[model samples]
Target: MPYPDEAVGFMADGPESFGTFTKRAYKLKPFEEFDIDVKVEACGICGSDVHTVSGGWGEQLFPLCCGHEIVGTAVRVGPKVTTIKEGQRVGIGAQAYSCGECKQCRNGNENYCPVNSINTYGSKWPDTGIVSQGGYGSHVRAHEHWVFPIPEALETTNVAPMLCAGLTAFSRWYATVPGRGRRLALGAETWAISRSRAKEADAKKLGADGYIATAEEGWEKPHLTSFDLIVNCANSSKGFDLPRYLSMMDVHGRWISVGLPEEEGQVIKAQNLISNGVLIGATHIGNRQEMLAMLKLAAEKGLRSYVEEIQIGEEGLKQAMQRMKKGDVRYRFILTGYDKHFARDLKI
Candidate 1:
């Protein structure tokens, strides 16, 4: 297949407002055996994109294309790649690559690999010395290992958010399971709090037996001590009446914290875990195997993402970023309709 000469999208200079994704062109790297070139059909805008663009998560590479939750068709695949083929519907998550020889990779925990881990965009690839780019473009070149074939039943718009938001929730959910017959409670706030409910719905679709939402009024009254695991996805540092919540858990219940509060130096009381034998832990994103497992689950359960669509072009991307900053999207915003020239493909 013939590759395009250029791809365009929103480009960020530094921690600025949402008006910064200006029109620009990027050169596609020469093809490699492990690489796959995609004609982007849809790309989900995640909070991480906003954070990276605004410098909330620290320094970022300039002229960055920030979208990570990507969905599209494989237009070109490297000769060495066998898992994916040309013209296949596919998606890429936040992580782009990881050193495969590490203990984490060997154990199917590539997300926690001790060596180098490459993010989908705004990070550097140790092998090629190229600053990794993102999915907010007319086309993207990715390693075949990082890209997965999308299931036939799922729509691009609905599956885009699953690349990041759904995967994050799913990784946490899978880690929290204790045994075959165990109940779990998910505590979340802000957008993630709502995502937790969606996660539970997906879990239920996958045959999850129990999930209780703590966001509703009087939510704690009924679910306290009802769960064997409590997954914290909320950012509140005041602590959600931990003692009360822990009291409801069965003995040896586990408490996992995935949300980081805005303020630094926040501490947890030891008594909360010590008194009840509740295990407290946190996790990063999943590795390649876990990502495949997640996609398989989504395929099997017919999971869908509640995403808002934004056209992929100079003006639409700027507006989409503005709306995302204001928390206007339901779950996620996907940039779509990228033609040969990203700026010209504005129909969406």
Candidate 2:
């Protein structure tokens, strides 16, 4: 097999099923003067990757390597790049471009760039005509705007998932005011009730107020129609009883779906939602400013994701993907040792 000196990644031929990862080379051409080159050190596996590779997120560009939660060391500095330098540690999230002149850009929400919002993977770069590949590769090419300098105190492995998964969860929670009124986060005990007591205790350490072990306690029967908002983060689409969840919502309550499952996974009955007069909505990845704020808060509070580290290799990546599909990872999976895996293959 030939090598892609410019960008080496474990990729798939097309969107189909999970565990189709194969190491291949992505030919890199000269990027714009504002673009910077990064040697990837670590990356987090996002649910978006699962969705895209499994044909759940609609058709995708084939031969794609999707991993946006990237942490790396900068080895090439474009002449026009003023902030990032060679040998600096940085990160890039799900976004690759947001034309700065748009209405959304003038606001602090550039991630919503209405004109041209380029994703980190599976999209063509406006500046260089390069279809943006993701971070599961030997190196990444990013524009100056989307690249972020990571904090010294944070480990690359810990901060990688914050790029997407943590960011999504954080963005929703940050804007909320749990203190303004009575509030409690509800999760069915089936999800939280780990086999061991240690798992239950770990939940308390994370500051969950209470546990609703649905199988034994039957929260729905006792607290029927008792909630205002629910942020459903479960990724599986099957067995989601939309009416059962709706029954728990008070009149005019809201349900937001952030966790994406396979296509046609969650069948929604229009009548189920009509009874409560409730609204359903969801959010995408946060903006650059939000990413910076997320890192700052993470640094200040010493917050880090509970991630299992796996050495980067074809077999290792395949196992990680499989584990994620089965819901085995505690929180996130970050792949490291990119330099060792592709030492001879990296062109620059």
Candidate 3:
């Protein structure tokens, strides 16, 4: 695959009228010694993409092409990029560029490189000022460190979501590290919590032992001080009952939030933590080491993400975005058929 002068994709012109998309071409950031050019094969549609485009996350670059869970081929590797070879399958997640000299980067925490961590899309390159676009396009340019080689066992489309959604869920810090005996013996129970029981069957089928519907009367009483850890995945804080949820935590349990809702977050007070003394924290996307480990574990376990594939086009994108906003997707959605949508002259 030859590198192209312009990357083509469906761009949203404004947040006010976001779900609508238009096909357009945007220039890639200036090539750097450590950068790698990827010819995208598939890109997962993440909830964050929706938030950013709809102005939920905040103001963003206009006419933006939004996507972060990217899986593709290494079409061009800079001279200094030794880890990946041209034509090798690779993936890029949320973070694209991090200053390698930062203490966080040196300590295997590049995801938190506060000095200069660039997102896969929206963040502008320092010197070039070219906004970093994402996998909704035909090509993506990212630093070598941010790119990961895909395992042969994982299918391109199925593994795409793991770059973001899977990784985000996998990297959360669990308050209690259960011993191997209990983990292997299957004594620990799992439960799914939602606003309604409509998805109870689906949750059970996904291996949850029980389900909790918050809409039910006294939903929190029966499960009081029961859970050892709670990983919050709420996409909004509009009506979230923070104290009620925290009451379900066992003594000294932890609540780790991984979701980023565009709306204001629920407020917490000393009173909320004083009852159970539970800890609360949040995390960003996983680091590179975690990304590789996650991919390797998925490959070894033969893990597959639940994903619906949609062809790459304006109408397809529009439909996907609309459906995603309504929570119609079972798990994740991946945009495919790139070669059909992007012009052949672009050398995808």
Candidate 4:
């Protein structure tokens, strides 16, 4: 299959001008036999994108095209590819490549493949200078192992963010077995904890059983030893109170962190986890099997993510990035209008 030599995207040259995207074309990496090229449709904006582009995480590959939550149609399939075909709808998550021979990959933990794991963006191919550009482009090329076939029942825009955000949410938890039931029981009560009460209404509206505002003093008193798990999605670790947050966890409860703020992470000392025997952990994006299971579950359950859509362009991207930094977006932002921004096939 014939593929384009270059792809156009809104590129960021440095952290100083991270939000200011300029339209430019970059050369595509050398395609291999197991690669698949996707025609861009909709891409999700993630906190990680903001952190990377702004140099919060660290120094990044300059002139980077940062977006990982990608959903599109397969336009070109290499001869070695078998599962995906041209015109099939697909999605690519944060990870694009992992050494399949590693222990993690062989055991269905490809996301943890420490050897030669390449991100969908801001990661360079080994022994080559070509950096991996992401979904914020006219097209993106990825290995077949990392490309997932989207379920027909799921909507493109709704499921786009799930590729990254949803996957992270999925693989971050470890539930304990109920002492009574032979089968896992349904209905685990979920509560939303925000820094303030501003989101209480919204959280309750979204089916949260209760809401806790940290701004209110003695907030964790009523809920002492109430939670079994806490998923920390905070964007920054600045001024994070570790002991207070852990106070709500029951014995043997876990705290899993999936957010990546550029700020230095809060240091966890032995005293912090000794009282409740809390387990603190973190994870990257989910593996290929988890991605497929997540999509299937979403389709069957008719799950919809709260998303705000913005057309792809310099101004739109700039506005989105600005709002993202301020926590202005409701939940997620999906970049649309690919056909209008890039002409058919992006013949540049």
Question: Which candidate leads the pack in TM-score?
Answer: 4
List, residue by residue over 211-265, the lDDT tens digit for candidate 2.
4443454456654666666667778756556676678776766666778776476
Angstrom error of the Cα, residue 166, model 1: value is 1.2
Candidates ranked by lDDT: 3, 4, 2, 1
List, in order, the clash count of every candidate structure: 2, 1, 0, 1
- Clash pairs, candidate 3, are none
Candidate 1 TM-score versus the reference = 0.81
| Model 3 lDDT-worst window of ten | 175-184
lDDT of 3: 0.86
Off by over 4 Å in 1: 1-6, 28-30, 172-181, 184-219, 235-249, 258-262, 340-348
* Residues 129-185 of candidate 1: C-alpha lDDT, one tens digit per residue: 667778887677777878988888788888888887777766744544556114332
Error of 2 at 294 (Å): 1.2
Off by over 4 Å in 3: 1-3, 172-188, 345-348
Cα lDDT, all candidates: 0.70, 0.75, 0.86, 0.85
Give candidate 4 regions above 4 Å deviation.
1-3, 172-186
Error of 1 at 230 (Å): 3.2
Give the runs in model 2 whose Cα sits over 4 Å from its true position. 1-5, 15-18, 127-129, 176-199, 214-217, 221-229, 247-254, 265-277
Candidate 1, pairs of clashing residues? 225-248, 225-249
TM-score, one value per model:
0.81, 0.84, 0.93, 0.94
Pick the winner on lDDT between candidates 2 and 4. 4
